[model samples]
Target chain A: MSIEIQNLSYTYDPKAKFKKIALKDVSLSVEDGDFLAIVGHTGSGKSTLVTHLNGLTKVQSGKIIVDGIDLTGKFDAKKLRSKVGMVFQYPEYQLFAETVQLDVAFGPKNLGLDEEEINVRVKDAIEAVGLDFEQIKDKSPFELSGGQMRRVAIAGVIAMRPEILVLDEPTAGLDPKGKRDIMELVLSLKNTLKTVKTVIMISHNMDEVARYCNKVALLKDGELVGVYTPAQLFEDDTVEKCGLKLPTTVRLARVLKARGLIENDCLLTEEEIVAEIAKGGRHA
Target chain B: MREISLGQYYPTGSLIHKLDPRTKLLITIAYIVMIFFIDTFVGFGLVFIGLMATVLISKIPVTKILKSLKAIIFLLVFTVLMTLLFYGGDKSEVVLSWWIFTFYKQQLIDCGLIACRLFFMVLGPTMLTFTTTPVQLTDGMQSLLKPLALIKVPVHLLAIIMSITLRFIPSLSEETDKIINAQKSRCADFESGNIFKRAKAMIPILIPLLTSSIRRAEELACAMDSRCFKDAKNRTRMNKLKFGWFDPVCLILFCALFFVVLWLKFNFLPFVDLTSLGWIV
Candidate 1:
């Protein structure tokens, strides 16, 4: 299954004096099992683009085809939403049920699944997000810690058993440890959950994008500059034109390469750069 | 969706905007009373001229003042229709006669007068809201109600609640918008449903909005406590409200207009009979 977007554009308050162009002529294809990271500066249409993936915002002008289902024409948006689960920024704010289990069961229940099936999905989804289902099931979601509440919120989306999981700044407002935990949970889902094949995440953290994402799409001023693999995106100069900083390890690798201390120009992680440094020393 | 401009203060350095909010409040009350006191067409004409002159002097756009009328347009029409249908007098002449529905010239005139009165009634307070900021209005309310504290009323708390409610309206609307979008992504269908189902669909959005609002209120309370925001009597304002020359001048002008309309209604227009003008039967 793949998501194909063609010439998607959106504008807020289109008829007002303070009209703003949020997205313009953006097109990209996300393949199955691809951990795609969308990186852009603030107001670069990253949030606007992610909202269109699951039919949250209507397509002003363009087309989106998800798994052979065309979203441009009259189609079941509710059915499309079931297939594409979206976790919004601060998803914890959307949790409303009296207990964590009930909150997590919301999506599955909305899908009209049987009660037994919803229960199974809710438990599994909570476990997938690394939350103990039995321990936190009866507790009010509002009483949980910020990190735990965010995990429960993500579990609520995961309970839908969607094929494409889209996250918009899932780790925003979290502590450093919380960020790492959330990212690892997402990474583990890709490896573990057969239902979630494609993961589309909008992130501002270049290091997280470099480490977890296989492909990166750079956007600037509502336009898609290019889509590249993590290594290629860091190695290319187009990333600079997009007004984005290179991941720390990639910048260090470029510096090492400039000093003639490293051979390869593309290095995404610190471990890779350290191995390259050791290899260069052995060669010397 | 940001075109909601009702009851929002227009910031401009004009005679009306510069008037002390206490004086503005009093003038608004006086204008409303005068609108009701007006009975003759000449009196209503004077009140209309006074309203137009205030609008001109306020330097606020005429369209904005007209926009405030849009909110009460339905009320105006309803009152006019009610008066037109139910007003009974010596029905010497009938304008239109139908089965159980009769229109008289006097009833039509009464409807027109009531419409004008209701129109001015809405416009008076709308002008007050347009010219004075919510903060100023609440401050004026607190100051005016300070005497009630002697009778054991919690004036300070009441003012704080009013200000807080006004302050959070826009923020709550923004939060509601966010929650709706978030829930919609979860396949929460809010549009297509029967009335009860549609209301049930709002549970997801409403619950989140409530939780967030409670969270915000708690945070604000904590922030206030940390900043030592208790004891409203000792709290000094950053922008103190002080009555200046403009306030008394505007107050006197409005009082004069009130008396002039009263005089016109009572004594000035005796020669012209309104029923003779084909407006009344």
Candidate 2:
């Protein structure tokens, strides 16, 4: 397993008047190179679990073995962080330096990389995020638009060269075009960056996640409700029960099936639905 | 990181919330001055009684008021300790004794008076903050400081900064928590380290948090610009401060309390005369 969580649990303000159990014995595993999409309602602890992978939240009563390193109050958290770089929801918030190049190079510098090596990593990371290395390198990140700032932030994490790239709602507050571009960029990075073996992301946009992620983990009230292939997981009714919506394609397929227009349950894509409709026409 | 409670205003139609924030602010300042001026138990009793009456009329939970005291517990204890160690009675004979320490009758009285002064200083203003929102506080400050603007004090700019700081505090705290957790998932332990190690570990969090804050500031600037928010431009307020019947009544009550405090401090109440008591020795 690229990442393994066993009976993990976490609570916040455990002794306060408003104590909360943010995670409740959630256990799951993701294989190397798995594009796992985590979905949940607000305050459902999806963010809590993914954060544990990098040691943001300590696992109170569980075992989180990520790439064979036990992250249970014993390991070097900073080294672990370098290994699994996280891109926050509003990635632009991570842009601290004046210039784009310096901002992108922050992670590499934190990793204690040499100046020459850090320069290469910054250039490669900028390129990996499909940002022009020369055109905007010297410009202040503050002067860039929202999309460019986000790219710079992502490149900052990419410069760390983590084995796993975890993102939390990376497309939040972005326009549709911006969202589409970010999703495509992540997919392209996965295709090109062989060392980036695992991509764990939390998103509420069910349709985009369904199209992009190979695996899906559903969380409800701090519990891992289910983990399955997107097709299988989306087919189940529990997703709706957990206050989450299914992908639009899955919803459309269900509607079509309910109308007696389709026979097969495996249709999840637009082209697949078209083929199924054509088959229905031929049979009729 | 929970949002700071300084801007936590429990909205109610009670007398305290209805009072003009400017009136409350002035009254708080005057009450604090009176607290320091009168140095006797009888004066403190009067202030305490007045504060209790205000609390009852405001209808705010006593628990919340007491909880606000939690933040200043250390200061309170330190003040008590200092009073015990430093003060001594001049006319009265010493009572209790320890190694190089003497407790006298007048020293105890002096300590009690100081404690009361500190208590009123903290409690009087806390009631104001808890009852009034940051927006109202800024508006009240702006109105009160209007004279300063003639001297190019930039009262409007100061108010804008205050409001923005109040507005972004919660947002930034939420972001900090998220970034901390994101770093934690990578196994970043903020707890269970020596001071140096802990400080070193915070670099990852601090770097990401600072970066994000700068970015947010830029985004906020853009958003403001797109909405045509220009510096030094007169803008209409969605909620304007106007003196209604409730405000006038509360203002009169506050004025009455201030005058009563002023009278009690200056005439009828005798100050403890601590300076002549040789308490400093």
Q: Which residue pairs in model 1 clash with each other?
A: none
Looking at model 2, residue B196 earns an lDDT score of 98
Model 1 spans > 4 angstroms off: A236-244, A251-266, A277-284, B1-23, B55-73, B80-109, B130-167, B227-250, B264-281
Interface RMSD of each: 1.1, 4.3
Tens digit per residue, CA lDDT, model 2, B1-281: 45356555776678778778888877777777767667667667777888898899899999989988887888878998998877645737777888988788787877777777787889988888888988798888877887998888987778888888878888878877766654554344568679998997787678767776776789999998998888743756777777767776765765676666566555544564434545332
Winning model by DockQ = 1
Provide the TM-score of chain B versus the true chain B for each model in turn.
0.84, 0.84
CA RMSD for every model?
A: 4.4, 6.5
Over A1-284, each residue of candidate 2 has an lDDT whose tens digit, in order, gives 38988999898878876778889988898998899999999999887787788876677898999888999868876678888889977877555566899878766775667999999999999989988899989998878988988998888888888889999998999888889899999988888987688899999998777788999898888888888888887777877898888777777777877888878755567677788888877766
